[model samples]
Target: MSGLDDVIAAETSLSEVDGLNGRLVICGYRLEDLAGRTDWENVLNLLGGRMLPESAALRERLGMARQRAFAETRWLDDGIAALSITEGLRALMARLPDGEDQETALLLAAAPSVFVPALIRCKRGMAALPPDPALTHAADMLAMLHGRAPRAEAVAALDTYLVTVSDHGLNASTFAARVVASTRAGYTSAVLAAIGALKGPLHGGAPGPVLDMLDAVGSPEKAGRWIGEALTRGERLMGFGHRIYRVRDPRADALKAALARLGAAGDVDRERLALAEAVEREALAQLKVKKPDRPLQTNVEFFTALLLEALGFPREAFTGVFAAGRVSGWLAHAHEQIEGGRLIRPQSRYVGPKAA
Candidate 1:
């Protein structure tokens, strides 16, 4: 099978990615129904069932975990100056104490928020700020990055981003997390493994490049000509395709909605957003003309770039921001996989030789 196409690797209650119909159902709720209505605390409650703390307690516990994770930021060494944000983050996660307890899981989830902004500050020669245990996860993260308390609307926008990407089906990084969990490894190791997988360009790295594409296009009038020339040279459009979804990605819509609201509130450039909307329409029309049989509609990367940019994150730090949201799902998946008590050892078909 090419890239394990149509293979059922494991059963999960985390989230469902319906590629045919372009719907994402997390736990028992539709993504559209759950994403904007709730925050990460409630999402974790749903995914963890009885394995995690209650929503109120989980918030308090995660706040403490974020403070605990501050100690791990000392691993942001001189060598980290040469590494990407995600690389620095993965290296820091590797140094965390390895364990499978709820403390370990919460720490791993909180570490990304703690480390990502600190590394960015370190790169800029600024002292790393400490987390505010009293703030919400989204608010604390933005405050840490900007060195002040975040605006309420900015916090809301980031909360939506986190909840939207909290979980999906067995994606590359999530599968890596589960495979490590299957070995009965500590949740920290599983989360570390997932971070490594997500660092790849094909997985968690596309959003930043989507920003690059928009920069190249420059204006709405230039979008069609720019995309055409790129396609003629066999360049893959960064945000226009997906691996599974035959229609538009549901996460794309969720994020677009968030951006629209942000734009309406004057938090972002409405003109730039209008240009992106034009690009999306042209890209979809061009994709249809190029590959009629294959649906290459806009995926999550499209709006992820716009939303994160609106949230004031630099393009390079986009993947690290992604890890912050996704670690929640990774911990949940790791815990669930560990309970199965069966190692994920799959058989490989030997087709290289016909010897007996």
Candidate 2:
């Protein structure tokens, strides 16, 4: 069971990752059916078992939650500021008033939207702008980050990104959250644990590097040669493979479609999209010949990079943005684990020094 592959750790009515079939199901709705059909507020309401208010009301509530979480902005200690985005996010979450209530969960979900833009602004020596509680969550995030009203296309693209990443089946971060919550720890503690898990390169950290890979390859004509060389050197072609899905990731297609929408609306760099499509084609073709037995296809991380770049986020902030979307899923998983009423205590077989 190396890497805990194929392990069934818990049961819940949240989301299911059908790896072989390349399907993602949230609650009862297919991910594809929900992607362009709803926004994050409604998605949260769906996963939260309708405990969350309706979309319009929830938008107002989350907007207010963003403002409340903004209060922690003043507590951005030097240590927090100096850390990486995910680390800084966890440090900031640790500073929130400890609680396990729904209100506290909402605050945790709202905190990243408030803080990520501030962190970006702080790094550039720009003063952070206050949240506009009236704007939709995605629109408000873009406005805060850019210090101006964002294009409607950009807002739509970011909303799709958020909704696409909101929840997946028992991912590492969600599992970490559930494990911590099983111990009766507060919601903040569970979310902090999830953030730590997500910071690892094997998980949430891959998308940023996907951009780096695309950059290094430089052009469409060079993509095949570049990927071949990377494979020869045993370097991963970031964003080209998934741990679960044997086919192209559904989220990849979802984000790619969002990027296309932006491109059609004249809001994104279409040349870059063209290059990415070429690279993806080359990567898939080369991967098939290189590893005949393994099915490695473009994943969510592939288009995640392109979309976030289009939306004005630095590659470094990718995981933090991902956490912003995924926090709701963590909240749901933690609550489910707590309600399940069983502590997660898995036994490990010792393979170390023997007792002779």
Candidate 3:
């Protein structure tokens, strides 16, 4: 069965999702290799590929894109006191003009602009912090969010996150972007469509719920019971299971290992990591009882919540940050779509009344 109740797209090279075997490939690189080691700029380079010049030119291009996006935060000229980040983001989005070439890259780079400033504006009861063009990409975002630069490890962790999520093959959001791209819509339209798709409960929105589950379970000791109850009620465990990656989210191990590299494995980190593992095991056990035919396993969201919490992003910002990374994939797809010059047109068998 297909996901489209609203729209249809034939195919695209944006990314591939292999749900049964638990594999995801972005462009040509496996996700695990790219997550922690590659910086956002590097991932952007990889995604943009030969279209982006190598070395200094690439850095200069990313720098330009970042600055262009940074400038867009000024569009937050209205709405306050009660607007949600989603509302604010959609509003700011409207200010951007359509003629911008491959508009997806700018939107992708602007994820920090949409999220970081909105975070501060909501918290500070003011407009928001301006983007600091001088800082590195992740560092600038953290600085905007907190009104100061982030610590080294935290910055690195965020970089890991952006790189990790930069793209995934045929995820709901990326696929949506490709679908829109197939229609030959302007790039920004495709990106906006992707963001709306991702906002769905089934996609990137799962991280915050994972955090809540962790809190309710409260300890590693209660993990098994929590899993049992959630399964009993037919409530899906937030962190466990992937539409792709049957065994594990390869990104999970990659991110956990990155967290270890922060060298902050004090009691808090250790406990969080342990509880995460415990939850994974118990969830798997319960899933075996309930869903024997298809074994569900841990997705990246479980550890992503813990890790982002450790890095000081509030639970609310988790999905926003995910948007920040996924925009990169959207841009790549936009570029591919534009170059192909194929107007995305698909036919569906009509099941509704039409004039004969």
Candidate 4:
């Protein structure tokens, strides 16, 4: 009660944070299991507590949602003269019609799969690839981002990434989403709130800088010295540590294993995989010596950079891809919050000027 007990509450289905043991679980399943064995759509269904409408029904609904989401991409063209990509995305998402219903909720969640990649591709003067009306959500996203349908391996890797991130209970952005949803706002409203929260550097602006760090270091040999300098400057390493995951981020290994499968099948760049392995070894070893008292481990963003980079996505596009997959979880959480019948409003203790 002294501090923000809402932040530390045992009930709220939030922050099952086991910092001492370094483990995170969502909805009673290990992050590793979803990331390793399932596709994004399946994981979404798991978190959402619904089957994906039997394959045929899912494909049909997904096709319709893709059309709805893709049409919004045109708004970005007008933004070429004015607004930034994130702003444009905010604008487009805001325009999604309001409702707490499941149909509109799916559309709200699927919008970024169509919009973000289209905007990024348009900025680079590349034509935006259309999503297949028949593919699963993750597959369609990868197809829409890249002209050729992603290889099976790429789809698998992306699916795992999505599963890893679908929802981590009341992560900052998801909590923002629930806050809006609790107001009986439409699903789009909830997701828009989540997107705004996610756009902040402290919350989700990570993968881009991870790529930048990798580019700056240039090779495995440089990782140790570079990390030492970064530590000396009291800088938080972009890909190291997390609010959860004390021993190692289970998601990191999940995603890494996903990438390894892609490498096994020859979809990922060999050199990139080699570089990541070297960085992993050097980073772990050096982190031990540099911060002897604290535990620092690789989180999802490190391998996420390598995987998304190999998948032909630009570093700037990384978070957008994250959004594409996570929106499902957002929608689910939104729906769950509404069904549970509680406003997400929490209070803070007065810590300033009480006497005054």
Q: Which candidate is the best by lDDT?
A: 1
Q: What is the lDDT of residue 191 in candidate 3?
A: 72
TM-score of each model, paired residue for residue: 0.97, 0.96, 0.87, 0.90
Q: What RMSD does each model have against the real structure?
A: 1.3, 1.4, 3.2, 2.7
Residue pairs that clash (backbone atoms under 3 angstroms), model 4: 22-246
Residue 117 deviation, candidate 1, in Å?
A: 0.8
Question: Model-by-model lDDT, in order?
Answer: 0.88, 0.87, 0.70, 0.74
lDDT of 4 by residue, 205-321 (tens): 688888787777788777778877877888777788876566887778887888888889988878666666776777778778878777789988888888888777787777777
**Tens digit of per-residue lDDT, candidate 1, span 59-149:** 8898999999998777777998569999999888888888878777878878899998898889888888999988989999999999988
Of the two candidates 1 and 2, the one with more favorable TM-score, higher being better, is: 1
RMSD of model 3, in Å?
A: 3.2
Question: Model 3, 1-356: lDDT tens per residue?
Answer: 26553343535554565656666677677776677767887787777754455745665555566566656665555453245555555555545565325334554556544455565456556656666656677877777777777787777888888887888766688777776766776667777788787777788778989888887888899999888887888887887777657687777777777667664634136777778778878887889888988757777887788877777677876777887777777778766766777776666677798888
Ranking by TM-score, best first? Answer: 1, 2, 4, 3
User: Of the candidates shown, which would achieve the greatest TM-score relative to the real structure?
Assistant: 1
Off by over 4 Å in 4: 1-19, 50-56, 80-84, 354-356
**Model 1 whole-model lDDT (C-alpha atoms):** 0.88
Greater TM-score among 2 and 3 belongs to 2
Select the stronger candidate by lDDT from 1 and 4: 1
Residue by residue across 1-356, what tens digits does model 2's lDDT show?
68898778998899999999999999898989888667777788888764455655777889999999888888776666788877777777888876777688788888999899888877777877899999988899999999999998888888899989999998889999999999998889999999999999999999998888888988899988998999899888888878889887999999989999988998778778878888899989999999989989889999999999988899889999999899889988988888889999999999899898
TM-score of 3: 0.87
